[model samples]
Target: MGRGIVKVWYDPEGDFLEVLFEKKEGYFRETSDDRVMEKVDMQGHVIGFSVLGTRNLAKMPLEVALS
Candidate 1:
């Protein structure tokens, strides 16, 4: 089997950054924090995550759970 590849998509216009663990079809669900979202597949596996307002948030220290 081959190793998994992570894909990152950043939109400067929207100031959004998405880090995809798997390049598959999935939808984003809001997490406990409004600035983050978790992407899951049909089976609800955390395939990736997203960060909103990156430019603004970069000024301060931030942390999030990814699992």
Candidate 2:
């Protein structure tokens, strides 16, 4: 599979997360299928993460993908 780079911005008050990534040069969705949305499972008790995207380096807050 082709790999894409992603940057995520989290907002506590907004209760939502925004992601900016380099889509496979010209594909709609570079990482997963061709959609811009996905699901995640939270695994901790924290407010935010200080890591990069949701890869091995992703420090998942509560193990959940910020929605």
Candidate 3:
């Protein structure tokens, strides 16, 4: 694994949260969890992820495997 600057954004009105591991061109894709989406680069390497209903997460922890 490598480490670099990580970017995170939260939309309170939309109850959404997005995180980026790298500032690269990528698209969001469905994960096992419907509320979770993974962003992958052109080579299909995971570069980020998004979560829906983030406010609801206060009741529990959010956990998802990113490939």
The global C-alpha lDDT for each of the candidates, from Candidate 1 onward, is: 0.84, 0.36, 0.89
Instruction: State the TM-score for model 2.
Output: 0.27
Segments in model 2 whose C-alpha atoms lie over 4 Å from true places: 1-3, 23-67
How displaced is residue 40 in candidate 1, in Å? 0.3
Q: What is the TM-score of each candidate against the true structure?
A: 0.82, 0.27, 0.87
Better of 1 and 3 by TM-score: 3
- lDDT at 27, model 1: 88
lDDT string, candidate 3, 1-67, tens digits: 2477899999999999998998889899999888899999999999999999987787866777887
Locate the minimum summed-lDDT window of 10 residues in model 1: 58-67
lDDT of 2: 0.36
Q: Sort the predicted structures by lDDT, highest score first.
A: 3, 1, 2
Can you write out model 2's per-residue Cα lDDT over 1-67, one digit (the tens) per residue? 2245556776565445544443222211122322234332243222222322324233433233433
lDDT for predicted candidate 3 compared with the true structure: 0.89
The positional error of residue 46 in candidate 1, measured at the CA in angstroms, is 0.5
